[model samples]
Target: MEHIVNMKSLTTEEMMKIIELAREMKADGIRKLDRTYYVSNLFFEPSTRTKSSFEMAERRLGMEVIPFAPESSSTLKGESLYDTVKTFEAIGLDLVVIRHPRDKYYEQLVDHMDIPLINGGDGSGQHPTQSLLDIFTIYEHFGQFEGLNVTIAGDISHSRVAKSNAESLKRLGANVTFVCPEEWAGEFDYTTDLDAQIENCDVLMLLRVQHERHDGEGLAFSKWEYHRQFGLTLERAERLQKHAIIMHPAPVNRGVEIADELIESPQSKILTQVENGVYVRAAIIKLLLKGRNE
Candidate 1:
């Protein structure tokens, strides 16, 4: 029943070490073939990057990837999450990757099972894998997060991205700042009174407001004000540290969270983040499996 729940299992060094290994696995050139190892992804909600990356990770490592999309799974037919998990466990899956809208969903399941859990995300609580990929991308680009001023903007309250990013960045030596409308700012509920949380950082990490997740949460706001107050506009982008980089964990809310202009800027690393994500996930799977025997 052991598991990697949120960032608790990773210190800055261990996390970076995993990401670096993931990179090497991705670059191995020769694809190994092993159809015996089974990995299951049990995600209750929708995700493109996460599911795909996990799928690619297993495939690249020669493991069998169980069907990932929730819509295509038996859970859509009134099966409780626990029942679904048990079914997968019964089938002797080697690893489980889960994402659910409720925080602690996997931890509760882990309490009952013999399998290992890799939490894709649990509501707005945390997305550790994404955080690792983000740090890896930044480290690969700049070689360091320390002394860098990095800003995470948008839907801070309900964004696992912002929460994990802030913690992950700081743990890795970056000075982190968060920007969002007061309602959706970082989960911390307080900023240190710096302008745009942009005073002196090397990067700006923009987060997308989950429009669908906010529908009933009462955190939704008009698109105009959203972009006006927090987005990276032409003028706003001009104010960054001369060498600052722009980052976003994508499925970006283009016109709303970031102006159309900044997405294509020389500083933008949105696509790069996506690419590195697959590599990092592959690395994690390899690391976990390789070390399972020890």
Candidate 2:
């Protein structure tokens, strides 16, 4: 069984193939994927975009989705994750999508499951599916990944999206840079001067202040200071290249991470990312099922 647990586990060719499939799926519009298979979601963490988008993707692909609500599930009664997953497997689910709040949490379940386990998000670890959809969105806009300067800003230390995007984009030959406060920005290609780097980069990807993780204490800066220094304010937005694009993994922090006005602007690809997410996820689900058949 093939599981998308990490972006680094996929080759550049494989990643590109998924993007190509997503583009085709988008162009082709609605279509049946498989009628017999069932997909399940077990999200231990709270989600709005990823959860809803994955469910939408499953429905579009003709799969009967069993969304496991952890709040009301046996897990709430102190049932072990292993038992819950085993119960699902015993009942004959074809695949499972898990989102846990513990880093490298899939280690406990991956070895035992007969079916594939796709990591929707695993705490401070990588979010491979998000990275794949991000790559698709970037490729759709630029037609290629090579030589594109992609700068990811905000909450780098706690962002699974930043880590996955950095690893995947660099493997595909895009120059990846992290912009954040000195405390959060470590050895990677990093910058504190967001304004200086704004004009040259082809993509300015901003991340949310993940308060849920570490109570948003990654940096000591106040909201105003952080916005003034790193947030994409109106003045900073004007400095972006004509063809540059802005992207964020949704439920944006608004004025704290990015200016509220830029959320709906032409240069912002936030909505486009949300739209492409369904197609990319559909492609991923289709690929994993196809491999099992083969």
Candidate 3:
């Protein structure tokens, strides 16, 4: 509870507590803290949803968000991540949220820092907040996780979302399946057939291909081919059960990861996931700060 670093480190009870708090906050609406807290975000990687969602969460909680640009920071002078974090600690900030490209980047800062650190993301390591929001969305729809069939498809090797969600969902008593091409499977056992799992799964979670992480190598098939085979084409989406939901942690590739029309379809919870992110993150910050004070 000290730092929201990895989903694997959280107990089932702890995870549920965050989800419950988020749900309550969503129902009750924003309630600013009696005292103001100052926070800063250090994202070394490119983002849209995660970064903005955290800022929204911080603002809603009445925390003063200190904006940061990695390009203009001391990092440009070769200052280390540890030094930069230490600098923030010295600046009297209450907490810091960081998203760095190095996997497990917070490992070096967590033990030494005085304030709590909420990991925005770290390489292909884990995205705990995103996982929480995704779980919240799922829980909101179904009211439970036990025995839910969750199939995650796409660039599993390079996705922090896939890694975080797979573990957390399985731990919460959901049956989790991974679908990806062999080259993108990474450490998990997976099948290349999205079609086979589509009808049976209660959740079809698509992922972006993450071309940036593929180094200089190109896919053997074109984007259209990938979409036809693995992506959620209109035909594939029709095969989903009525109760089934589609989700993507997006900056969506539109037609690349899913059919463009399906992004806002009735069964798609993609935007709801984004909306819930702010609440889930607010709950996390509240819990971490509450724990720190006690």
TM-score of each prediction: 0.89, 0.96, 0.99
Q: What does candidate 3's lDDT look like per residue over 186-241, in tens digits?
A: 99999998889999999999999988888988998999999998999999988999
lDDT of each: 0.76, 0.88, 0.94
Best by lDDT: 3
Arranged by TM-score, best first: 3, 2, 1
| Deviation from native of the Cα of residue 41 in model 3, angstroms | 0.5
Lowest lDDT 10-mer window, candidate 3?
Answer: 211-220
> What global local distance difference test value does model 3 have?
0.94
Q: What is the alpha-carbon lDDT for the whole of candidate 1?
A: 0.76
Window of ten residues with lowest summed lDDT in model 1: 186-195
lDDT of 1 by residue, 124-199 (tens): 8999889988888888879877787777777788888887877778777787766666666544755623354654
Compare candidates 1 and 3 on TM-score and give the better one. 3
Q: Predictions ranked by lDDT, top down?
A: 3, 2, 1
Candidate with best TM-score: 3
Which regions in candidate 1 have their CA more than 4 angstroms from the true location? 26-35, 72-78, 189-196, 215-221
